[model samples]
Target: MENVVPFKIQIISILATLGFMYFIVRQIIRGKLREEYSIVWFACTIVLLIFSFWRKGLEQISLALGVFYPPSLLFLLAIGAIVTFLVHLSIVNSKLQSQIKDLAHEVAFLKEKQLNESTIK
Candidate 1:
Protein backbone atom coordinates (compact mmCIF):
# COMPACT_ATOMS: atom_id res chain seq x y z
CA MET A 1 0.00 0.00 0.00
CA GLU A 2 1.14 3.55 -0.78
CA ASN A 3 1.97 5.85 2.13
CA VAL A 4 -0.65 8.52 2.72
CA VAL A 5 -0.90 11.68 4.80
CA PRO A 6 -3.95 13.57 5.99
CA PHE A 7 -5.30 16.53 3.97
CA LYS A 8 -5.16 18.80 7.00
CA ILE A 9 -1.43 18.26 7.44
CA GLN A 10 -0.79 19.21 3.82
CA ILE A 11 -2.91 22.31 4.20
CA ILE A 12 -1.04 23.31 7.34
CA SER A 13 2.29 22.91 5.57
CA ILE A 14 1.08 25.12 2.73
CA LEU A 15 -0.19 27.80 5.06
CA ALA A 16 3.10 27.72 6.93
CA THR A 17 5.01 28.23 3.70
CA LEU A 18 2.78 31.15 2.79
CA GLY A 19 3.31 32.69 6.21
CA PHE A 20 7.06 32.39 5.79
CA MET A 21 6.89 34.07 2.40
CA TYR A 22 4.79 36.88 3.86
CA PHE A 23 7.33 37.46 6.61
CA ILE A 24 10.15 37.74 4.11
CA VAL A 25 8.16 40.17 2.01
CA ARG A 26 7.46 42.32 5.03
CA GLN A 27 11.14 42.39 5.94
CA ILE A 28 11.98 43.42 2.40
CA ILE A 29 9.40 46.20 2.42
CA ARG A 30 10.68 47.46 5.77
CA GLY A 31 14.26 47.63 4.39
CA LYS A 32 15.65 44.96 6.65
CA LEU A 33 16.59 42.97 3.55
CA ARG A 34 18.10 44.63 0.51
CA GLU A 35 16.91 43.99 -3.03
CA GLU A 36 20.05 42.09 -4.00
CA TYR A 37 19.99 39.98 -0.83
CA SER A 38 16.34 39.19 -1.43
CA ILE A 39 17.17 37.58 -4.78
CA VAL A 40 18.74 34.64 -2.95
CA TRP A 41 15.73 34.26 -0.72
CA PHE A 42 13.32 34.49 -3.64
CA ALA A 43 15.32 31.90 -5.52
CA CYS A 44 15.33 29.68 -2.46
CA THR A 45 11.55 29.96 -2.14
CA ILE A 46 11.06 28.93 -5.77
CA VAL A 47 13.38 25.96 -5.37
CA LEU A 48 11.76 24.95 -2.08
CA LEU A 49 8.26 25.20 -3.52
CA ILE A 50 9.23 23.01 -6.44
CA PHE A 51 10.80 20.34 -4.25
CA SER A 52 8.03 20.40 -1.65
CA PHE A 53 5.36 19.96 -4.28
CA TRP A 54 7.44 17.35 -6.15
CA ARG A 55 6.59 19.15 -9.36
CA LYS A 56 7.65 17.18 -12.39
CA GLY A 57 7.65 20.19 -14.69
CA LEU A 58 10.01 22.12 -12.45
CA GLU A 59 12.30 19.11 -12.19
CA GLN A 60 12.36 18.87 -15.94
CA ILE A 61 13.21 22.55 -16.23
CA SER A 62 16.00 22.20 -13.71
CA LEU A 63 17.43 19.29 -15.65
CA ALA A 64 17.14 21.20 -18.87
CA LEU A 65 18.94 24.16 -17.31
CA GLY A 66 21.79 21.78 -16.36
CA VAL A 67 21.27 22.27 -12.65
CA PHE A 68 21.87 18.78 -11.30
CA TYR A 69 21.28 19.99 -7.75
CA PRO A 70 19.08 23.01 -7.93
CA PRO A 71 19.49 24.65 -4.50
CA SER A 72 23.19 23.92 -4.11
CA LEU A 73 24.04 24.95 -7.64
CA LEU A 74 22.13 28.20 -7.37
CA PHE A 75 23.76 29.04 -4.05
CA LEU A 76 27.22 28.27 -5.38
CA LEU A 77 26.64 30.47 -8.38
CA ALA A 78 25.44 33.37 -6.28
CA ILE A 79 28.42 33.17 -3.94
CA GLY A 80 30.84 32.87 -6.82
CA ALA A 81 29.42 35.97 -8.46
CA ILE A 82 29.61 37.91 -5.22
CA VAL A 83 33.23 36.91 -4.75
CA THR A 84 34.09 38.03 -8.25
CA PHE A 85 32.38 41.37 -7.69
CA LEU A 86 34.25 41.91 -4.45
CA VAL A 87 37.54 41.20 -6.17
CA HIS A 88 36.70 43.76 -8.81
CA LEU A 89 35.83 46.31 -6.14
CA SER A 90 39.13 45.75 -4.35
CA ILE A 91 41.00 46.47 -7.54
CA VAL A 92 39.05 49.67 -8.04
CA ASN A 93 39.74 50.72 -4.47
CA SER A 94 43.47 50.38 -4.93
CA LYS A 95 43.36 52.51 -8.06
CA LEU A 96 41.34 55.20 -6.31
CA GLN A 97 43.77 55.28 -3.38
CA SER A 98 46.70 55.86 -5.73
CA GLN A 99 44.85 58.71 -7.40
CA ILE A 100 43.99 60.29 -4.08
CA LYS A 101 47.61 60.16 -2.95
CA ASP A 102 48.72 61.79 -6.18
CA LEU A 103 46.18 64.57 -5.75
CA ALA A 104 47.27 65.20 -2.17
CA HIS A 105 50.92 65.51 -3.17
CA GLU A 106 50.02 67.89 -5.97
CA VAL A 107 48.03 70.09 -3.59
CA ALA A 108 50.87 70.21 -1.07
CA PHE A 109 53.42 71.14 -3.75
CA LEU A 110 51.17 73.98 -5.04
CA LYS A 111 50.70 75.36 -1.54
CA GLU A 112 54.43 75.31 -0.85
CA LYS A 113 55.17 77.10 -4.15
CA GLN A 114 52.57 79.79 -3.42
CA LEU A 115 53.93 80.40 0.08
CA ASN A 116 57.52 80.76 -1.20
CA GLU A 117 56.47 83.20 -4.00
CA SER A 118 54.53 85.38 -1.53
CA THR A 119 57.51 85.54 0.87
CA ILE A 120 59.82 86.65 -2.00
CA LYS A 121 57.35 89.42 -3.07
Candidate 2:
Protein backbone atom coordinates (compact mmCIF):
# COMPACT_ATOMS: atom_id res chain seq x y z
CA MET A 1 0.00 0.00 0.00
CA GLU A 2 1.14 3.54 -0.68
CA ASN A 3 2.30 5.62 2.28
CA VAL A 4 -0.57 7.97 1.63
CA VAL A 5 -3.27 5.82 0.10
CA PRO A 6 -5.68 7.37 -2.32
CA PHE A 7 -9.23 7.92 -1.05
CA LYS A 8 -10.77 5.79 -3.75
CA ILE A 9 -8.55 2.84 -3.01
CA GLN A 10 -9.30 3.13 0.69
CA ILE A 11 -12.98 3.23 0.00
CA ILE A 12 -12.73 0.20 -2.23
CA SER A 13 -10.78 -1.70 0.41
CA ILE A 14 -13.37 -0.84 2.99
CA LEU A 15 -16.19 -1.99 0.77
CA ALA A 16 -14.43 -5.22 -0.04
CA THR A 17 -13.82 -5.85 3.62
CA LEU A 18 -17.42 -5.16 4.47
CA GLY A 19 -18.52 -7.59 1.78
CA PHE A 20 -16.27 -10.27 3.24
CA MET A 21 -17.61 -9.64 6.70
CA TYR A 22 -21.16 -9.92 5.45
CA PHE A 23 -20.33 -13.20 3.79
CA ILE A 24 -18.84 -14.51 7.03
CA VAL A 25 -21.94 -13.56 9.00
CA ARG A 26 -24.13 -15.21 6.44
CA GLN A 27 -22.10 -18.38 6.63
CA ILE A 28 -22.28 -18.43 10.41
CA ILE A 29 -26.01 -17.91 10.41
CA ARG A 30 -26.47 -20.65 7.84
CA GLY A 31 -24.48 -23.13 10.02
CA LYS A 32 -21.56 -23.30 7.62
CA LEU A 33 -19.37 -21.80 10.37
CA ARG A 34 -19.65 -21.74 14.13
CA GLU A 35 -19.90 -18.65 16.33
CA GLU A 36 -16.60 -19.53 17.99
CA TYR A 37 -14.71 -19.58 14.74
CA SER A 38 -16.36 -16.39 13.54
CA ILE A 39 -15.22 -14.19 16.42
CA VAL A 40 -11.54 -13.89 15.48
CA TRP A 41 -12.46 -13.00 11.93
CA PHE A 42 -14.94 -10.50 13.26
CA ALA A 43 -12.31 -8.89 15.47
CA CYS A 44 -9.83 -8.88 12.63
CA THR A 45 -12.30 -7.19 10.32
CA ILE A 46 -13.24 -4.68 13.01
CA VAL A 47 -9.56 -3.85 13.43
CA LEU A 48 -9.19 -3.51 9.68
CA LEU A 49 -12.29 -1.33 9.59
CA ILE A 50 -10.84 0.94 12.23
CA PHE A 51 -7.49 1.07 10.50
CA SER A 52 -9.08 1.73 7.17
CA PHE A 53 -11.12 4.63 8.50
CA TRP A 54 -9.12 6.18 11.31
CA ARG A 55 -5.57 4.94 11.60
CA LYS A 56 -4.55 8.25 13.10
CA GLY A 57 -7.04 7.62 15.84
CA LEU A 58 -4.87 4.74 16.94
CA GLU A 59 -2.07 7.12 17.83
CA GLN A 60 -4.49 9.19 19.86
CA ILE A 61 -5.88 6.16 21.62
CA SER A 62 -2.41 4.82 22.26
CA LEU A 63 -1.28 8.14 23.68
CA ALA A 64 -4.30 8.25 25.92
CA LEU A 65 -3.60 4.73 27.07
CA GLY A 66 0.05 5.72 27.82
CA VAL A 67 1.54 3.43 25.23
CA PHE A 68 4.98 4.06 23.78
CA TYR A 69 3.77 3.89 20.17
CA PRO A 70 0.62 3.56 18.14
CA PRO A 71 1.58 0.55 16.05
CA SER A 72 1.79 -1.43 19.26
CA LEU A 73 -1.97 -1.41 19.10
CA LEU A 74 -1.80 -3.91 16.28
CA PHE A 75 0.23 -6.27 18.43
CA LEU A 76 -2.21 -5.80 21.28
CA LEU A 77 -5.06 -6.64 18.96
CA ALA A 78 -3.24 -9.71 17.70
CA ILE A 79 -2.86 -11.00 21.26
CA GLY A 80 -6.50 -10.28 21.98
CA ALA A 81 -7.49 -12.13 18.83
CA ILE A 82 -5.42 -15.13 19.83
CA VAL A 83 -7.01 -15.20 23.26
CA THR A 84 -10.46 -14.98 21.76
CA PHE A 85 -9.69 -17.86 19.40
CA LEU A 86 -8.32 -19.96 22.23
CA VAL A 87 -11.47 -19.40 24.24
CA HIS A 88 -13.56 -20.47 21.31
CA LEU A 89 -11.50 -23.57 20.82
CA SER A 90 -11.86 -24.42 24.48
CA ILE A 91 -15.61 -24.27 24.20
CA VAL A 92 -15.60 -26.45 21.12
CA ASN A 93 -13.26 -28.89 22.80
CA SER A 94 -15.60 -29.21 25.76
CA LYS A 95 -18.49 -29.98 23.47
CA LEU A 96 -16.40 -32.59 21.69
CA GLN A 97 -15.38 -34.16 24.97
CA SER A 98 -18.98 -34.55 26.03
CA GLN A 99 -19.86 -36.15 22.74
CA ILE A 100 -16.92 -38.49 23.03
CA LYS A 101 -17.96 -39.50 26.52
CA ASP A 102 -21.46 -40.26 25.33
CA LEU A 103 -20.16 -42.38 22.50
CA ALA A 104 -17.82 -44.27 24.80
CA HIS A 105 -20.67 -45.05 27.14
CA GLU A 106 -22.81 -46.23 24.29
CA VAL A 107 -20.03 -48.46 23.00
CA ALA A 108 -19.46 -49.95 26.43
CA PHE A 109 -23.14 -50.71 26.79
CA LEU A 110 -23.20 -52.46 23.45
CA LYS A 111 -20.10 -54.46 24.25
CA GLU A 112 -21.59 -55.57 27.57
CA LYS A 113 -24.78 -56.62 25.79
CA GLN A 114 -22.79 -58.63 23.32
CA LEU A 115 -20.82 -60.31 26.09
CA ASN A 116 -23.99 -61.31 27.89
CA GLU A 117 -25.41 -62.80 24.69
CA SER A 118 -22.24 -64.77 24.13
CA THR A 119 -22.36 -66.14 27.69
CA ILE A 120 -25.98 -67.16 27.24
CA LYS A 121 -25.07 -69.10 24.10
Candidate 3:
Protein backbone atom coordinates (compact mmCIF):
# COMPACT_ATOMS: atom_id res chain seq x y z
CA MET A 1 0.00 0.00 0.00
CA GLU A 2 2.84 2.45 0.79
CA ASN A 3 4.54 1.67 -2.50
CA VAL A 4 1.30 2.23 -4.35
CA VAL A 5 0.86 5.60 -2.69
CA PRO A 6 4.27 6.87 -3.85
CA PHE A 7 3.59 5.67 -7.38
CA LYS A 8 0.29 7.46 -7.44
CA ILE A 9 1.88 10.62 -6.16
CA GLN A 10 4.57 10.43 -8.84
CA ILE A 11 1.96 10.08 -11.58
CA ILE A 12 -0.02 13.01 -10.26
CA SER A 13 3.07 15.16 -10.05
CA ILE A 14 3.97 14.45 -13.66
CA LEU A 15 0.46 15.31 -14.81
CA ALA A 16 0.47 18.52 -12.84
CA THR A 17 3.86 19.51 -14.26
CA LEU A 18 2.63 18.87 -17.79
CA GLY A 19 -0.47 20.95 -17.13
CA PHE A 20 1.65 23.81 -15.80
CA MET A 21 3.91 23.70 -18.86
CA TYR A 22 0.90 23.72 -21.17
CA PHE A 23 -0.65 26.69 -19.40
CA ILE A 24 2.57 28.71 -19.57
CA VAL A 25 3.08 27.93 -23.24
CA ARG A 26 -0.51 28.83 -24.05
CA GLN A 27 -0.18 32.15 -22.27
CA ILE A 28 3.03 32.94 -24.15
CA ILE A 29 1.53 32.00 -27.52
CA ARG A 30 -1.51 34.18 -26.86
CA GLY A 31 0.74 37.12 -25.94
CA LYS A 32 -0.79 37.34 -22.49
CA LEU A 33 2.61 36.61 -20.93
CA ARG A 34 5.84 38.06 -22.15
CA GLU A 35 8.64 35.75 -23.28
CA GLU A 36 10.93 36.85 -20.45
CA TYR A 37 8.34 35.89 -17.81
CA SER A 38 7.39 32.71 -19.61
CA ILE A 39 11.04 31.65 -19.68
CA VAL A 40 11.19 31.63 -15.90
CA TRP A 41 7.94 29.68 -15.60
CA PHE A 42 9.04 27.23 -18.25
CA ALA A 43 12.31 26.63 -16.42
CA CYS A 44 10.44 26.04 -13.17
CA THR A 45 8.05 23.56 -14.76
CA ILE A 46 10.90 21.70 -16.39
CA VAL A 47 12.69 21.37 -13.07
CA LEU A 48 9.47 20.08 -11.49
CA LEU A 49 9.03 17.56 -14.29
CA ILE A 50 12.57 16.36 -13.82
CA PHE A 51 12.10 15.80 -10.10
CA SER A 52 8.73 14.20 -10.70
CA PHE A 53 10.21 11.60 -13.02
CA TRP A 54 13.30 11.06 -10.87
CA ARG A 55 12.07 10.50 -7.37
CA LYS A 56 15.44 9.20 -6.26
CA GLY A 57 17.16 12.38 -7.35
CA LEU A 58 14.66 14.46 -5.39
CA GLU A 59 15.20 12.32 -2.31
CA GLN A 60 18.96 12.66 -2.61
CA ILE A 61 18.72 16.41 -2.91
CA SER A 62 16.46 16.65 0.12
CA LEU A 63 18.86 14.58 2.13
CA ALA A 64 21.78 16.65 0.97
CA LEU A 65 19.97 19.83 1.95
CA GLY A 66 19.34 18.33 5.39
CA VAL A 67 15.61 18.37 4.92
CA PHE A 68 14.15 15.32 6.65
CA TYR A 69 10.96 15.57 4.67
CA PRO A 70 11.37 15.61 0.89
CA PRO A 71 8.21 17.64 0.29
CA SER A 72 9.68 20.51 2.27
CA LEU A 73 12.32 20.89 -0.41
CA LEU A 74 9.62 21.72 -2.91
CA PHE A 75 8.38 24.52 -0.68
CA LEU A 76 11.91 25.82 -0.29
CA LEU A 77 12.44 25.85 -4.04
CA ALA A 78 9.11 27.64 -4.55
CA ILE A 79 9.98 30.34 -2.04
CA GLY A 80 13.36 30.85 -3.61
CA ALA A 81 11.78 31.17 -7.04
CA ILE A 82 9.32 33.76 -5.75
CA VAL A 83 12.12 35.77 -4.16
CA THR A 84 14.18 35.67 -7.34
CA PHE A 85 11.19 36.75 -9.43
CA LEU A 86 10.40 39.63 -7.13
CA VAL A 87 13.98 40.86 -7.36
CA HIS A 88 13.80 40.76 -11.15
CA LEU A 89 10.58 42.79 -11.08
CA SER A 90 12.14 45.30 -8.72
CA ILE A 91 15.09 45.83 -11.04
CA VAL A 92 12.79 46.36 -13.98
CA ASN A 93 10.64 48.78 -11.98
CA SER A 94 13.69 50.80 -10.95
CA LYS A 95 14.83 51.11 -14.55
CA LEU A 96 11.40 52.25 -15.69
CA GLN A 97 11.18 54.77 -12.89
CA SER A 98 14.51 56.29 -13.86
CA GLN A 99 13.45 56.58 -17.47
CA ILE A 100 10.15 58.22 -16.53
CA LYS A 101 11.93 60.79 -14.39
CA ASP A 102 14.37 61.61 -17.16
CA LEU A 103 11.58 61.98 -19.69
CA ALA A 104 9.61 64.25 -17.36
CA HIS A 105 12.63 66.45 -16.84
CA GLU A 106 13.21 66.71 -20.58
CA VAL A 107 9.60 67.69 -21.18
CA ALA A 108 9.78 70.36 -18.49
CA PHE A 109 12.95 71.76 -19.95
CA LEU A 110 11.49 71.86 -23.46
CA LYS A 111 8.34 73.60 -22.23
CA GLU A 112 10.36 76.20 -20.34
CA LYS A 113 12.51 76.89 -23.40
CA GLN A 114 9.43 77.35 -25.56
CA LEU A 115 7.87 79.76 -23.02
CA ASN A 116 11.06 81.85 -22.84
CA GLU A 117 11.14 82.18 -26.68
CA SER A 118 7.45 83.25 -26.75
CA THR A 119 8.04 85.92 -24.09
CA ILE A 120 11.08 87.28 -25.96
CA LYS A 121 9.01 87.49 -29.15
Q: What is candidate 2's lDDT per residue for 1-117, written digit by digit as tens?
A: 223345787798799889989999999989999787787789789878877797466666777899866667768878887897789789989999999999999999999999999
lDDT of 3 at 108: 100
Candidate closer to the true structure by TM-score (higher is better), 1 or 3 = 3
Of candidates 2 and 1, the better by TM-score? 2
Candidate 3 error regions (>4 Å): 1-5, 107-121
Per-model lDDT: 0.69, 0.82, 0.86
Query: Of 2 and 3, which scores higher on lDDT?
Result: 3
Query: What residue pairs are clashing in model 2?
Result: none
Q: Alpha carbon lDDT of residue 54, candidate 2? A: 75
Q: Tens digit of lDDT per residue, candidate 1, span 32-103?
A: 987775676676566555545653444465578887765555467568867876786699689999999999
RMSD values, in order shown: 7.5, 3.9, 3.0
Off by over 4 Å in 1: 1-67
lDDT of candidate model 3 versus the reference: 0.86
The better-scoring model by lDDT among 1 and 2 is 2
Q: For each predicted model, how many residue pairs clash, with residues at least 3 apart or on different chains?
A: 0, 0, 0
Best by TM-score: 3
